[model samples]
Target: MNSMDVVRVLARYRFSYTNEISLQDQIEAVFKYNQIPYKREHRLSDSDIVDFYIDGVAIEIKIKGHPVAVYQQCVRYGSHDSVKEVLLVSAKNFALPDVIGSKPAYVYFLSAL
Candidate 1:
């Protein structure tokens, strides 16, 4: 699926996460429910490991932490050759640029869903 398709699929999910791990589990369920193919803990490099991967999109799940750190992490993920975009799933809302390293970046806020 494309970036927007991924976002729409995730937006339909009703998140009930208590932590990062739970959020990941909920995301996995959403993918399964939608019959979307994905990989968990996909390693982009020695230092970059994404929470999930679908097609050319790298998915990251974050329940807490600094937004800059998350953005930096997504930027690193976007640099990978296999990734065409980055999808950030967070429990809270934060500003993230639409593009990072020429790859599109999209965010799905759990609270907004």
Candidate 2:
């Protein structure tokens, strides 16, 4: 799947209203359910580790706090050479940022559905 398609698939996933599955696990489960291939922490260096890199996109799940920090995190991840897009998946909606430097960026609200 492509970047946008992966976003769509992940956007459709509704986490069970329970404590068993974590946000991170839910994300991975959704990706697996859709049969989309991904690599965790496709490292840029020793410290910069994006949560999930799929189809030339960086998907960072931010379930709490303000969107600005998450958006900035997306920007940082988008700067990587292999990343063509960045998906900032959050619990609340926020204004999407324009293309950061060169890579296209998108925001997907996980709770929108």
Candidate 3:
């Protein structure tokens, strides 16, 4: 599925815990329940790792952080050859732009639903 499709699927996911690890686990469960193919904790390089990678989308989960740092990280992930888009699942709404670099960027806040 595309990044937006993946986001829609994840948007329906319900979470009882808000911790980063728990959120990751719930996300993995959602992907499995929907039969979505993905790689958890995908390593892009020695220092750069994404929370989940599906098709050409790289998803990152953050419970708390400076918005700028998170966006930069997602942009770095987008720079990777395998990633065509970036998705951030964050606890707080960062109001990120529609695109980061040449690839599309999306964010879903856990606090919303």
When superposed on Cα atoms, how far off is each prediction in RMSD? 1.5, 2.6, 1.4
lDDT per model vs. reference: 0.85, 0.72, 0.86
> Residue 75 of model 2: what lDDT?
74
Lowest-scoring 10 consecutive residues by lDDT in candidate 1? 9-18
Ranking by lDDT: 3, 1, 2
Model 3 C-alpha lDDT per residue in residues 1-55, reported as the tens digit of each score: 7888987897776676757898899889999999999999999989889999999
lDDT of 2 by residue, 1-113 (tens): 55678777865667643332377788887778777788876785576788888878887766675767766777778778888888776666765666875988877766633
For model 2, state the Cα shift of residue 67 in Å: 3.3
What is the C-alpha local distance difference test score of candidate 3?
0.86
lDDT of 1 by residue, 9-103 (tens): 87666777678897788889878887899999998989999999999899898888898888889889989999999988778786679999998
Best by TM-score: 1
- Per-residue lDDT, model 3, residue 102, is 83
Clashing pairs in 2: none
Candidate 1 CA-lDDT value: 0.85
List runs of model 3 lying over 4 Å from the truth: none
